[model samples]
Target: MKILNPFRLGLLGGLGVLVAVGIGQTVISLATILTYVGAALFLALGLDPVVTWLETKKFPRWTAILTVLAGVLGVFTGLIFAIVPVIAEQVRNAVQATPRLVTAFFDGTVRENVETALPWLGVQDLLDGFNEWAADLDVTTIGGGVFAVGIGIATGITGAIIVLILTIYFVSSLNGIKSGIYQLVPATKRAKFIDLAEQVSAAVGRYVIGQGSLALVNGVLSFIVLTLIFPAFGLPVKYSALLAFIAFMGSLIPLVGTLSGSIVITLLVLLFNGSPSVIAVGIYYLVYMQLEAYVLNPRIMNKAVKIPGALVVIAALAGGTLLGILGALIAIPVAAAILIVVQQVIIPRQADL
Candidate 1:
């Protein structure tokens, strides 16, 4: 008894380690469920403003919510039906046109079209540029790139289905969900928490609305532009329908959104529509992005969360790191919420202190 009971202490430590391991596994098991919940919560917040607006015009809350959900679900279902054929055609075209795209651009026939599209680059220079760029390209790398792209598209589709299912459930029970959350907070701070939560929610809602409007404009314009440009260069725009959705997702990230899209757009245009059309698409984005940054943003997000450009970039990167594309899409709104908390809560508390 006086020897310090080393065995008992060791046994207790081992049990503690086992408990910790059990807790970690529990968390890992819950991750997928949590992800679905998070997606639904964010989507419901995004749709809340439209629901509230409908209510103001004398609609019942349930009616407004259901109407919004129905419209979203209907449009998404229709879009999938419309895009399936287009994507199939596009992939087939891409696979078939790979060789022709390389030769046609360098053949001097499309040079005038290229010059007209981007006056900054001469015809010879454009082909020469591609040649110079391609000098370092390996056939293996191209094959891998195509494979990776296919995998990404497949994953995005699967994730979209899960999100759609979860979003409907969350939107249907959003009011009850919020009330339940309120009950979780201590009574002493419940009212204050509700007020803060409302403010943050409104900020996120506005941001989501603004971002969605921008994405719509981007996607529609992409479809129109690609459809018009592709045929002019003797290529097909049969898949232009699917291009809209691609542009929509690509436009969600703050700064890098268009850049990431440009790579895909350029590759597609170069491989199928020729480099001149790629330049046309590039020029279109160059102009559109400026208008978006200056005009559309000011009008749409005038009352939304305001953050610096650098912070937007950093938040998008961090969120993308944590949760993939969905994180990048919602990163701005999250950053905005944090900013609101800092201004409304932390700074005031610090001042009182």
Candidate 2:
């Protein structure tokens, strides 16, 4: 090689670093948009299997898309009507109950029970500390915090609408999108690339459907048990609708979702309805977890994703650490896609070498 000019090499390296930094800044600026697009794409993939199934039943692609969209809208509309009012009413009740709850806590009976349970703990001291802290809070700071929360809620709602619109577009044009992407591959490798890509997409679709089914099952069971069965058995479960909604949302993540939701619901039940309800809720969740693992998961997810248990845990933890809920939600399918590529391409290439 010709001897490199030191100044030129250093200048080029600096230029490269500047270009990289510019690109990173651009990426940081576009993070919110990218997140919206990713979430939309994910939802579209999840809905694809349903659209495909409708097509198999002799529905035209457009008709299938409409059918699926209508069903989704109808479900959401129904939920808004059915669930929102109950949740709102319960929330209002909770707000109204706050004063009474505080009064009861300060009353001798509740404090005595707590002090009796933990002899070393000082209930009065804890209350005094809490009161002092509350008294010391700045009104301006509190107002600012409330304003921030309002802004966050508004942003979340707007983002949700954007994601929904993008999801509909993606689902309608998914086939076209895939065809366009396939056109980019070199002619010689295009066929194989298409096959692999289709496999990965199908796997992702299946996973989303399976996970949603599990969440639906959990939500329905939770609502039924807490709202009806518990009350029938004289084990009151306050805010059952809200609790069930939480369960449904939490179960969207793999592996850890159900356990986490169960813990939260159990604790809330204990707080609201005392030890008897907690015991019932605890036992129910323990049995439910077993059934979910052995029966529901096998039937629902057997064909969707088959990653090793250890890898599943590892992927979920790593993804959760990196990107919170969304990362955890997508990690398993990403891992599955990697596995497919390794099995199909890397292993074969290695063997040939």
lDDT per model, in order?
0.78, 0.88
Please report how far candidate 2 places residue 196 from its true position, in Å. 0.8
| Best-matching candidate per TM-score | 2
Question: What tens-digit string does per-residue lDDT give for candidate 1 at 125-223?
Answer: 667787888998999999999999999999867877888888888878888989999999999999988998998788788888887888888888888
TM-score of each: 0.79, 0.91
lDDT of model number 1:
0.78
Worst 10 residues of 1 by lDDT: 267-276
| Candidate 2 per-residue lDDT over residues 264-300, each given as its tens digit | 9886765556556777888999999999999999888
- Model 2: colliding residue pairs: none
lDDT, residue 67, model 2: 96
> Where is model 2 more than 4 Å wrong at Cα?
108-141
